[model samples]
Target: MAASPTPSVSRAPLGTVPPTWLGKRPLPETSDGFGVRKPTPPELRVRRFTLPDTVAMLPGTGFASAVVTPAPARVIARSTWRPGCPVKATDLSWIRLTFRGFDGARHTGELLVNRTVVDDMVSAFHDLWDQRFPIEEMRVTRRDELDAPPTGDGNNTSAFVCRPTVGSSTFSQHAYGLAVDVNEFQNPYTKGDLLLPELAGSYLDRSWVRPGMLTPAAIGAFAKVGWEWGGNWHSLQDRHHFSRDNR
Candidate 1:
């Protein structure tokens, strides 16, 4: 065989590296930084028509797309859990009703009042999730207390992160309690070139899934309230997500 030349490496650095500069402004220190402004509400991708099923046809449809409605019913369970399952407040009000497991278990007795909001929402969901996970092995999760997602570090079993659009895009529904990221294991979130995968095995495995096999019934309940499921996006299909546009 003839000897092949080895590819040479260029040791020189390219031209001058300039700092990332794009017109970006910080959050208004006061409200005026926002000029003569009326913060327009985000238009939900779901409200164009009544959702006929849990998986509604995306308004402008193409491949790998369908709006997954927020499955409020999927929140069949809830309870409070500290970072390490520690007891922070025997006092009561500090406790929150979080999803303890997918099987209809409620973590009441504790106060964690902020949970009242989530509780109201979850209560609306429990009726929807009963059949999806079954009573055998349901999952548990809480967002307000989770490590800022991306817990992306592969340690978390459930957590998804959708970064802001470029810079200070707009107020997202997530900010106003209109969006949700569910059991991260069953979904993988994306942004531009990033495919931050959830480390759980089932979420990444495609064999267990068939086209149109998503749990649609659960998603519909959430759509009733205007939340849009990210799973329905055309480019990337994140099954465990639903949101109501920018809040």
Candidate 2:
């Protein structure tokens, strides 16, 4: 699967498949290539607002669990989807699952993904949950939030945003609902001076090994289902990303 360029306003023709690593290039020496030369200020890492957990956990059912169903019409209405998007709403599924939060409490979260990969995503997240991987939050991406003012410290775990690739006019795998971004603040996307969540520079220091940070084991959990981790990419590191096509 080819990776789309950075987020852009132009749209690709319907059904057009983007080329792999479309606009990727080597990072400059000054760029934080896989290590951090300077740390971000604590204030910059703080979230502008914290979203309250939306689901309650029941007592004594201490195992990872998931529920999958057809994508709800209401969810679609709030999502970034519009007609002519790469994937149809009917081909997507809504998933709700239990995850361990940074606070070490179990919480329910939701995602929207292509129906074909629904089982794979369920299995991968269950493994993470069992391993006690901490995710700050998980929810559907709303259309209004796509270009909302950057909170800088967002860590929303989400899948599916109907938009072009980061720097190109091509549709992102995300447009097809085949990609997921987990804990964006803890494991951010970085490429040649560009960071997805602009204030997440501190997380570039993979050596810190904080909770919610993805490990080799976590990568393996997704790999088990044939999903590729962007952390493994050479030109850029999207540590929070996982996708079916190595995008």
Candidate 3:
């Protein structure tokens, strides 16, 4: 068969073949990319004061003459009064606080409770609640009502999922247990599946009430109670949520 016609193929010019070790990584950006996080001035300022130990044991620790910070809103304008659970000036030990969730469930943490701080936190929540739920027909659910587990990474939690990245910080005001998440159905995290459509009218919205679209009024209510909003994050947002200083 004529040596099978020596089936040979021709090669292209040596330079036409690409280098075998070429890299595909993208080139780094020069001086300007965009969307960097800017720092905001913190609004909270702390002042020390004595709290009588006798008042610290009241249920949820109500207050009387606490030396709290003035509420930004007027619903509880006289919050400068005594706290429900004032710390005795002599006892500098931190007190445990219960951060309530939309459900009645709570996680325990501690904070420096002087009459002033507790009163400030309470008055803040009161005004916040009134502003956030202004419609008379609408009602704010008790912290005990929404019982999802805390940020679930690996630890055991009764909550639907552990979202530590979106939760109170280890050093957070929430560490002081000064925050809560109401109607979690309203605050859907990016993890897992999306929330049911039925909940949209109340808690879920892509705009003013979406993950990062939370309103200042909504944030203020929880912040007054010492809870910080996850919505404040630039890269992510949780509309129906609140926590304290990231803890």
Highest lDDT model number? 2
| Model 3 misplaced stretches (Cα beyond 4 Å) | 1-117, 132-176, 191-204, 208-214, 222-227
Ordering by lDDT: 2, 1, 3
Candidate 3 lDDT, 1-247, residue by residue in tens: 4566767899753422323321221223223221121221121011011112222332543221223232222212212112322222222223333332222222232233333346544454355434433110111122332232221111001111112233232332222223344333334343223222111223333444432223566567656566566656655544444554453
Residue-wise C-alpha lDDT for candidate 1, range 1-247, written one tens digit per residue: 9899999986522211111321122222224122121221122101011111212222322111111123222331243232322222221122112222322332111112122234334443454444333111122234443323232212122211222321255633333334455443345554443343322323345455521223566567666656677777876665656655612
Which ranking of candidates, highest TM-score first?
2, 1, 3
Evaluated with TM-score, which candidate comes out highest?
Answer: 2
Flag the better candidate by TM-score, 1 or 3: 1
Enumerate clash totals for all models, in the order shown: 19, 7, 40
Candidate 1 lDDT trough over 10 residues, lowest sum = 43-52
- Provide the overall lDDT of each model, using Cα atoms, as 2-decimal numbers: 0.33, 0.74, 0.31
TM-scores, each model vs. reference: 0.39, 0.78, 0.32
Global CA lDDT of candidate 1, please?
0.33
lDDT of 1 at 165: 28
